[model samples]
Target: MDYIIDVKELRKEFTSHSSRSGLKGAFRDLFTRNYTIKTAVDDISLQIKKGEMVGYIGENGAGKSTTIKMLTGILTPTSGHVRVNGMNPHKDREQFVRSIGVVFGQRSQLWWDIAVQESFRLLKKVYNVPDEFYNTHMADVIETLAIEPLLDKPVRKLSLGQRMRCELAAALIHNPPLLFLDEPTIGLDVLVKLKIREFLKEINAKYGTTILLTTHDLSDIEALCERVIMLDEGKIIYDGALRQLRENWGEGKQIQFSFAEEATHAELQSLTHDHLVVWDQGSNASNWTASVENNEDIISAVIGQVVGAKKIADLKIVEITTEEIIRNIYEEGAVRNG
Candidate 1:
């Protein structure tokens, strides 16, 4: 199979320098230096197929940015190998970049003082995009992102959400087969985020553009990616389907029941020994909450036990969130290491 991205034992390292503070020590430090070697990316390997949207997620300082930089030819790896589209990104940077588009949420790639359209035109000249292709692509992007109204406005004057929309459009003008999106929805309102998500889905389906998305938002993963790669301390801890991650690591459902008649603590305890039940006074003195596995049999058994003793007025069951499952994995790893 031909993979768009193939990484083998990729590693990146950095050096930190420290100097003495006092004048005498400073003078001595001029002659002697202390350096500490930090590994930002450990030996990691990954393969992504053409047109596949993969979520690359991790906590801060987990080497997500470092790996992206290497893939985009902005940073050189210390050791090992990386190949994108059958080419070494760092070795043939000029050619490699023409095949890929990148967006950094906190950084602006547009000219601050220029109109959004002018920025698009400038990118067209820089990338040498043909007139026919440019016109069609820009039109599609403008309509999809709803940026027609903001075309004449300067990049510096647009709101965060508007600027992000333009940023995405600018990156897509060349119609690169691969796209790297780093926190593309950061700092946007709910409505704007939804628009952006919709645009991404449309583009991926229409063009089959392969995407590698990195974000702190787990919802983005749930909405966009079927496969996820989770990193920790410069290493990948999990790489599989999103559903499998939930099945393997996710905590089960949390169920709450509102009873018409108050049941004593002893009565509740006698009903089930498998679940942890707590009286919720804020909702109602008779309401109770239980933490239980997501198994149908277990849930049915618990429900039967409760209904047998008390009349249930209302009930709600909430499944565990992706954030909670990832957090639990990190905490468990820490505990085991300690």
Candidate 2:
């Protein structure tokens, strides 16, 4: 009903020029131009309600960054419409930006030569943040991100993890209702990643900030987002709850069982018929694996039957991960097109 970000049939295209490599071909190309038009985003439609943390994910060159740029008003759409926080992001850039915050991991937004605290104060003044609110928020942010040690140092002198901590604190100084994050935890160590994730969770819970994150890290999605929108080759391929995506696109359960003795030929056939044995013992006769149907009840039934009939020696249940699910989707998409 109340949506903070709305897009309808959104599309963006870019025109690029290409020329031949050799000098002779270059001379011939002087009178002619080879222009190519590529669509960066194609017929994208999405809506995000307030306070919803969603992951916008895809492989490199999949148009995730282009969509973020359009949503943030850095680039205008080639066609269709985009609205954020009840205003046209491109047309109302000045007023629209006041309601949103952006952080790109590979770029620095803070003042390079100034101390972190100085940059924070400047942002406070720029955003017209009330002194009372700024003071209260600064205290909480400093403690939550543990950036107090880095505040006195110049932004250019801080390490990546320290700078990222300060960058997050700087983004929150304005208290924007909507935040756009592009690979916020990229290239950081595991400990720093954990700290940043915790900080993001607290910010979302405390300020009700709507976050649209684009990342190659599926772990970030698993920890932070319940919903996911997957893009591929300039088109939206999947959008749904994370759990539902896992259930619908997953490879189901795979388990390997090594028995002290093999089951009878009829017993093995019966199991294979219903269970879909993915790997079976030929010469070994005592080792095999089954990729059961993607149903809990079926898995339970098969496992119970195995325990009763076969003398179990070793068993392994392969765990399904979010990364594997996404990889499967991409592979399937490739097959569909090829």
Task: At residue 173, give the lDDT of candidate 1.
Answer: 90
Q: Across residues 1-338, which tens digit of lDDT does each residue of candidate 2 receive?
A: 98999999999999998887899879978998788999999988999999999999999999999999999999999999888999999999989888888899998889999999999999898889999999998999899999988888999999898998888888888889999999998999989999999989999998898999999999999999999999998898888899888777565876678889865556766755665554545457787766666778877777777877778998888756789678867977742210
Q: Please report, in order, the local distance difference test score of every candidate based on alpha carbons.
A: 0.89, 0.86
lDDT of candidate 1 over 206-323, digit per residue (tens): 9999999999999999999999998899998888899888887665776788889886667777788766543334365687776677788888888888888789899888787899
Best by TM-score: 1
The residue ranges of model 2 lying beyond 4 angstroms of the native Cα positions read 256-292, 295-315, 334-338
TM-score of each: 0.86, 0.83
- As a TM-score, model 2 comes out at 0.83
